[model samples]
Target: MKSDMTKGNIAPILIKFMIPLFIGNLFQQFYNMVDTLIVSRFVGADAMAAVGATGTIMFLILGFANGLATGFTVLTSQSYGARDENRLRHSVANAIILAVIVTVITTFISVVSMKGILRIMNTPDNIFDYSYAYIITIAYGICASVFYNLGASILRAIGNSKVPLYFLMLSAGLNIVLDLVCIVGLDLKTFGAALATVVSQGISAILCFVYIYKKQHSIWPEKRDWHLEARDTSHQLRVGIPMALQFAITASGTMIMQAAINLYGSVAVASFSAASKLQSLITQGMPSIGQTMAAYAGQNFGAGKYDRLKGGVKNALIIMTVYSVVAAILSTSLLEPAMYLFFGSAENVAIQLPWAIPYIRFCAICYIPLSAIFIFRNMMQGCGFGFLPMMGGVVELVSRAIMAALSMKFMIYELASACDPAAWLTTGIFTFVAWLYVAPKIERMFSGRQKVID
Candidate 1:
């Protein structure tokens, strides 16, 4: 169902909207987490590391697409809030066109660079072939991932987060079934896991596309809405490129961190990979909150309800803070069992637990700062304060790069683990400061409008 967040009780509406998003993100992460689970448990730790090895590169490519899709949806949300169906319709169509263009380019580049990227990251020889097989297979289906991300993002922008959750649940189930069939039954190994992910995502993308094509409502476009408006395209790129750069910048930092992690050899890689997956599962709440804040901020900003937007930010911060605490507790509890699940309970594999535990704990501790960064940065983006978020991205990049360099130079792999919290803390500070600077200006702008109307 469609929602008008512009006038509702801020906290309830935001919570209701975010719950499905939170669930959907869990299922979405499961698409890969399942792959890792099945591959590690059924195949081996090396296989798990192979899948894990692809994470940063995939993040670099798919993260950019997701960010672009998210940036495009800000326009849709604002338009929906303003009840400007024309703008919403045009933005949707143009955004789809842009997604198609970007998907093609990204897929091509990723496929071509897969092996080279793995080599540059210094993928260990034992896992190199497995990593190549997994990533190349994933690269082949990049369009599916990008399409689903764009389609789902557009839906949420219009206050229909539930539909995407339904789609993801379906896709995730299918992925698990395929994982069993391919990895267990057929014993297809790493390639099978990657193929399962692509095919499942493709199904979700197709389903989402069909739904939007047929809906023809407020945010969905009809035949008449299919034309490309140069103005809309320009606006999309203007907003989207910065967001995309922000994601790419952040991913590049992770890429650096991954390279640093790779220097430690396969055991370290496998442990880090497994631990990273668990942390990702725990930290889903941060992104869910950010996404909810984005929609809330966009809608209220477009409706010129600056105070409502502020209220949404405050409520979202509370939500994220509570979630961060819960996540830290859960992560600390599960980190051990999760490692056993991934690397096996075998005696030889037990040695990796010592290395993995500290990294996972560090990540869990960092969730608090991460929550602040995600909420503030995404809120800024949704309110169309694009530059601040972009600057926050820059902060993230610099902090991680610096930390990773120091860690690698000193051979303190644990210090490499500290990079995440450091980046989150620095970027959170920047975004918080930016919000402080900008909130008053927005209030003044709207205050003048209210006075004129009076």
Candidate 2:
């Protein structure tokens, strides 16, 4: 089931690897959107906005854990590329240990600090309790999010994207059913949506772990593999910490933007939330291609296939450019209908459309830079250059913070909406520039002309 990216036609291999990733990503987003739809319809707009308001803080905490899991896999992907079974198994073991440590720490911190963090985000009075209930429940289930991401990242590392897709599809279906049962049947409201997400993710994690146990015996850790070594642990943390910081830093910027949005009241929050989800669904291709590049570049880099690495990046850019155009077209075309679907009523749509439509359209036209952010950032990470992407995250944070600050001062909806585009543009340029600096050094290291430390 493991497809090696170090062989075969570059475009076809990448495309084949990318399809499952895209579909899996789509279903993941679909279920998330379902959460919002059900919440809005059954619990009302304020409830939907309450869930939405927790978005950035959740991203800040959960994104950090997910990022660490992803960074841990870079080494796994590399070991797989080098055909180092012993090292690959060690990497997997260390990753599991690290994931456990992270889960405990993040869960405790996030759960304890949930209410204060929501308050800091300027959550409106009407939705404050709802936000607390939703996010706190999600925080309690952080292990589910962490383990699922770790499992999926490990699968992708070994070039087996299909298995995770299958489990995720199962998770999505279960989530929809649970969302209805928890929200409507049990009258749990926002907490039900969060609980459904956590439980579904937990199921996917268990299934993914089982699959890896049964099928990936070659890379599975033995008793010896579980004995942690300082060098291996250090290596994993070197990549994982920076990657986690990158996600945390970027989420902080969004947290700032969310604060700005909160000032605009519940309607703006709900509209922005709905529009953002729609954009994410439409633009799934960008991240999918980025993830493909991560594995592709990781495997090729491990194999010392510099030309193939370069070729993969080139091919990815072409694919992403074409996909970005298609995504932009789809976002613009689907705006009205998508808004209607999210709110489930024309009356709600009429109120939110004026704010949501332009925001989505603006983001659609800026997909190229957004595409660049994903491709180059993941390419760098895949190539064992984690620090560069973390710096790129700083660039994103600064851009969003400045935009959010300006939006707050001016009291303008347009400025608030501009936060994402601005951050993408800035971070995209930074990552591409970082790549130019790192690529030559990678080639030199491969050529034995220079020594590079990852």
Candidate 3:
């Protein structure tokens, strides 16, 4: 809502902003992918599988928290655009207070239920220890994750994407260093990866707050700014809860999928994990444009610049759609080489390569429609229609459940029929199904409201 991403020379400005965001997000995935890469290379495929084991659960809780913060970011951006300093300050204070409580509660819940959560997912017997250790270690540091996201969202809200990107860059470098040292030098194994991530996130969060306090003129919060009314907190939760819940539901669906993956045995688990790691390397940049669109939509909508808001959405679609197609093409052509680089053992590589090819190709296509969903959610959230994003989440959850169930049945069918293509087909079919559900909704959101957004 702060920077007018829609107003400038569209091509040049989009390139400038989105490039940094794209690079930063790619590096962010590097923090994650490094774990799988190093562990698979060093600790054995089982250890890598252990790291993979935590993914859906981690995405579940972490996604919800980040989504909640993003909602606050959109709100703060609009408040700042309207030059309502008091509301911005209030938003910041309340966000901090709320995030702290949620972090603590989530930490307690996650830690206490770590084993149960893993059990529900039917995480492979061999990798259970690594999963538990990783989950517990990260949950213990949930406070750091919360702070980092809250701070980053604050920076983005006030049009300081570069600042958070800078902090994340710093954190990513630190993460790489720590990951290597922890696993290789310290021999902390899976725990080391979680520790490295937590420590890096904490440092970034702390640095972010310091930066916000000193330099963000519109966002500086005084002691008196800390008091929050129940209604306002509820209001933030109202806007934020659905976002958080959306992630939770998606994660739950993924957890089911994770259980299904585990049913396929260690080779299947390891192969799927390798592909997920590699694909994230390409697809993670979608959020940058999504967030950019959200900011543009929020600022203009707040200023009642409806025409610009409409134009901005069109601009975002053009930008993200092109990238998604390119990503799909690259993934299809390069899937084998990428697998060779990231995975291990002749058997492991062979098992993973085929599965990755079809899954990523489908993802590339999904990215096309999916990008529109992200842009629309952010746009809707920016326009103060926060609940639309929640509806999207529900759609995602339902589609995901259907996809996973069908995929599993397909997997079982393949087993019985001696059809090896079942796994890859399951993936491609699900990817298409997701896009099918998501694309129609995005088209509907803008079909009648085709006023150009700023």
Candidate 4:
């Protein structure tokens, strides 16, 4: 069901909305982690390395598509919060048109360039084929992933996060079954994992499209609204292009980091892969709160409720800090068992744990700063302060790139582990600066409102 977030208690609403989003993100991460889990255990370490090798590439390509879709939703969220039904419909229609364009362009470019991209990442010869197989399979299915992201973002924009969560649960469950069948039963290996993801995403996308078109009347576009206007399209691109570039820019840093890890050979690659997967599993709450803040801030911003917007941010930081401490504790306790589970042997554990454990520890304890970066950055994006957050992405890119380059000089793996924290710290500072700058401007909007009344 569609709910309006323009009114009501901000904290409770944010928590309620964030729970579903957090769970939904869990399923989404589970969707990817399952692939690595199955591949590592069933297919051998090389296969796991192959899958890991494509991680940054997938982020680079799919990240851009997902970013564009996410950017488009901000406009829809603002329109929904303001109760401008006409503008909401047009925003949805234009977003759909834009998604189509992005899907085609991204799929073609990523699929054709997969080999060269892998080479640039310094993927070792032994694992190159496995990585290529996985990347190509997923590349072909890029449209499915892009569509699902667009559909889900739109749903969340209208305060309908529950439906997307439901769909995601279904997709995650289905992908696991397929992973078992394809990777374990049929022995399709890396290709199988990628294929499972694509098929599951396609089903989720279809469900989202059906529900939005047939069920949700509030934000559905009519035939007349389907006609895209140059000005509106420009407006979306204005908001969306930066959002897209932000993700691409951030992914570039990760890609650089991955490239550095690649130079350490497959042992390092596989270790990083398993550790990163585990990190993603535990750290879902960080991004979930950030996403919830985005929607909450968007609605409050649209309604000219600047005070409520600040409340949302304050509550989110409190929640984020508490969760960060809890997650760090849990991660420290479970890190070893999780590693053993992922690799499944004392021998494999011995090899991977050295690199994986310290990296996870560095990341786990640093969640406070990490959470700040995501919340403040996304809050700005929600308030339609897209450019500053985009600049935060730039800060992430530069910081991570510097660390990745510097990690090459150090023999200690902790240097590499420190990269993310450094990036998060700098990015958090950038985002706070952005929030400080944007807050005054937003306050001035309310000032204008009071003057109008006077």
Ranking by lDDT: 2, 4, 1, 3
Clashing pairs in 1: none
lDDT of 1 by residue, 66-85 (tens): 78877877888888888898
Weakest ten-residue segment in model 3 by summed lDDT: 413-422
> Which regions of candidate 1 are displaced past 4 Å?
216-218, 346-349, 451-454
Report the Cα lDDT for residue 4, model 3. 52
Q: CA shift at 27, candidate 4, in angstroms?
A: 1.4
Estimate, for each residue in 213-232, the C-alpha lDDT of model 2 and write its tens digit.
99998888989888667988
List runs of model 4 lying over 4 Å from the truth: 449-454
Question: What is the number of backbone collisions in each predicted candidate, taken in the order shown?
Answer: 0, 0, 11, 0
Give the local distance difference test score of model 2. 0.91
1 or 3: which has the higher lDDT?
A: 1
Global fold similarity of model 2 (TM-score): 0.98
User: Measured by C-alpha RMSD in angstroms, how accurate is candidate 1?
Assistant: 1.6
Q: Candidate 4, overall lDDT?
A: 0.87
Question: What ordering of candidates by TM-score runs from best to worst?
Answer: 2, 4, 1, 3
Per-candidate TM-scores read 0.96, 0.98, 0.88, 0.97
The better-scoring model by lDDT among 3 and 4 is 4
